[model samples]
Target: MTDSTHGPRTLTVTEDFAGQRTDRVLAACFGDLSRSRIKNLIDEGRLRRNGEQLGNAAEPVRSGSILVLDIPAPAAAFPVGENITFPILFEDDDLIVLDKPAGLVVHPAPGNETGTLVNALIAHCGDSLVGIGGERRPGIVHRLDKDTSGLMVVAKTEMTHRALSEDFAARRIDRAYLALCWGVPSPTKGEYEGNIGRDKRDRKRMALVERGGKEALTRYTVLKAFRVYAALVECRLATGRTHQIRVHFSANTHPLIGDPLYLRRIPAIAKSCPTDARDVALDFPRQALHAARLGFIHPRTGEKLLFETSPPEDFLTLEKALGSD
Candidate 1:
């Protein structure tokens, strides 16, 4: 059953879902809504089973039980539009590409509640922002880490959003990053493959593991070597796992220079560089990684699109200080 108003949806539990948790059943039924949302509905008494308000998301469901969910419209959440603006690399009817700078959070969160790329996009896109995915993150197709600078694409329409998301999930998008690591990776170039998941000891960080993790692959090539202290490398992602590039490189002991999370301590190579370059290597503010290139097909027009951007001034300054040796 379905109701247009209030988005009331009814689902009848079948043998397939019998004995499953109510939240799990609802998650399967409403693929677009997150499981947390379903739990919130349960807590708010908006979810009912057999005409009785069900407050526990983990309650077991019986076969043939009827479940009703009254989903409220999403609120206009955080990251309200601000006067802040970013550089637009490309724009069209379907999407907008931006050259995001380091230190800018991609979306607002608990600590970062304003002045995000979403806020800028909201101001820039205005009413053209498509809210099909969620009100808080309109048109956001993918994200770059707050400290990783460079090219990013955001959808302006639902059609483009779905198509672009599918492309990313299917690994059809071409993403390349430029990184300066503590030392030159061996053999100049190779593929780094591993399974990645949360670090059991440190939940906030991702780690490479031998099991129970998602497969991640990254191909890298050294572009320039700076003495024995650092090197400029190009990385292409085959699987975009959380902190995939950073985790993989760190696991290989060539962590990105200035990476606070992955690189635990200053590498011995840092002391070997020239005085100025050594100072730059030790004092760089953020990770020396940039999403330098991005390519994907236009969701609507089917035209292949590619965009490239150089790293920010700070990154370039550090690189120049390092020089080629």
Candidate 2:
């Protein structure tokens, strides 16, 4: 039998294994699964025999009895504290502001079960960091893409989480990003407004859609342009949506430099740049976008709070290479 990670699987007992225990037979059939795991699944009522749940892992298997094993989708593990480094800007009973790195995931998911910012926060804050609404993890009110580096605020208490979430929802939070895109926007200063939704053709990517997408607005100003090849721009979000910045730029034919999902091919604008500069931009390992500034009213202090960070070294290097400066 296969691992059946996708869904439930069934197998027939043969005369060669007529009298064996159910768990042992399952372990034998599912060579990739351990005997203990099969037993646990059986205990969890995940194993069925002849359309009835088999509550006993040690029950005898009859010849030709069909055993169906349901493999539940793997869940992210109970997060444990792990030491990871991030620049902490501020921390209090309400929240902690930190500069998240380009490669750090905000939390665990199916494939990323460890080495996340939440794991590090758990290690750093210990019992001080409570789970979000009773889930055993940090209160992440907002998130940057796994590869989009920069400022983020994590909540320490439930009250803070609720307050921060409300602010983000009401667009009371101020956020800005810097990105290197293939071409300069014609007006140099404008807003890209559209509804963003999952691309109909590609489930993994977001796109601007005429219907069924959330309204998104990205106000941008070109900070610098590299001949006709590319430009570094600052974008402020008026409405938050998945992949809002990348999708907006890409939709305008100004796809971000080194964006893996959006920049699908070599851009025509690259021909105008020196080969080295073009190479630097194209060879960049991740999307050339960074969260540069974040501001909001402190939930507890009521004093205005703001945090800013220079783009990571790779981003700056790409910018420099795109121009002589």
Best by lDDT: 2
TM for candidate 1 is: 0.78
lDDT of 2 by residue, 30-140 (tens): 887789778756654577788866656776899989889997686754688899989999988778999999999988765788999888988888866746633444778
* Pairs clashing within candidate 2: none
Q: After the best TM-score superposition of candidate 1, give how far the Cα of residue 287 lies from its true spot, in angstroms.
A: 0.3
Q: TM-score of each candidate?
A: 0.78, 0.77
Residue-level lDDT of model 1, residues 93-174, one tens digit each, is: 8899889989999876556778889888888878668364567778888889899999999998888899899999999999
Show where candidate 2 strays beyond 4 Å: 1-74, 133-137
lDDT of 2: 0.85
As for candidate 1, its clashing pairs are: none
Candidate 1 lDDT (Cα, 0 to 1): 0.84
Residue 105's lDDT within candidate 2 is 92
